[model samples]
Target: MYDLTGFQRDLLYVIAGMDDPHGLALKEKLDQYYESEIHHGRLYPNLDTLVEKGLVEKGTKDQRTNIYRITNRGQREIEARRGWENQYLDESATPT
Candidate 1:
């Protein structure tokens, strides 16, 4: 997790929140969050990085669509990251 870029970490969080989201679905969510288009060249390669790191698992949904889900390791990483953040943030503090 520490080795991941901020964009990759953002991708991981989005993946954690959604249920078996496809690449385009993840892109849509991120595009909304970023208030801009998330190009495929940027999206897919980062997704592949997460897959390679064993944090995300990719599976085929059908002929053309592939779905992504956070692996157990990914969930653990998220929990750890939250704990680390909590140490420095007040309980009432909210990200903007």
Candidate 2:
């Protein structure tokens, strides 16, 4: 949660938003969101970090593909983060 880097947090959100996203799919989503290319060396290692932290699980989809999903721990963290954010943000707050 608080220990995760911003990029890793973004990764978690993207993974949560998608259905069993793989490396390339995650990369594409990030690229579109960031409007720039994401390097493999950067993406996979962070994913491995999430797996090691037990916030995410990695599973094989095929000979050449791997899928990712957030664990229950990860979901709890997301909820906690939302709650923490809501503490300072009014529910009806709108963009200027």
Candidate 3:
């Protein structure tokens, strides 16, 4: 997670939520979340980054589409991030 860029983090979250997330599906979901069109130039490279980092595992869904899944490392990273975020959120809400 510390090694992950913002785009890679988003990709991890998206992959975790989906069963067999492919490029197009990932792009669509990201576009909706980002409220902008996700171009091929941006999406694929970030996905590759996740694969390189061992946070995501890639596989072919059929003859064409390549699917992605979050690995155990990815899950641990997500949990770590959530815990880090909770510390800030909790402190922010506490009376000064």
- Rank ordering of all candidates by lDDT, starting from the highest: 1, 2, 3
Report the lDDT tens digits of candidate 2 across residue range 5-87.
99999999999988899999999999998899999999999999999999999999999999999999999999999999987
Sort by TM-score, best first: 3, 1, 2
The residue pairs found clashing in candidate 3 are none
lDDT to native, each model: 0.96, 0.94, 0.92
Candidate 1 per-residue lDDT over residues 1-96, each given as its tens digit: 999999999999999999999999999999999999999999999999999999999999999999999999999999999898897786558676
Is candidate 1 or 3 superior in lDDT? 1
Misplaced by over 4 Å in model 1 are 91-96
Deviation from native of the Cα of residue 88 in model 1, angstroms: 0.7
> In each prediction, how many residue pairs overlap at the backbone (N, C-alpha, C within less than 3 A)?
0, 0, 0
Q: How many backbone clashes does candidate 3 have?
A: 0
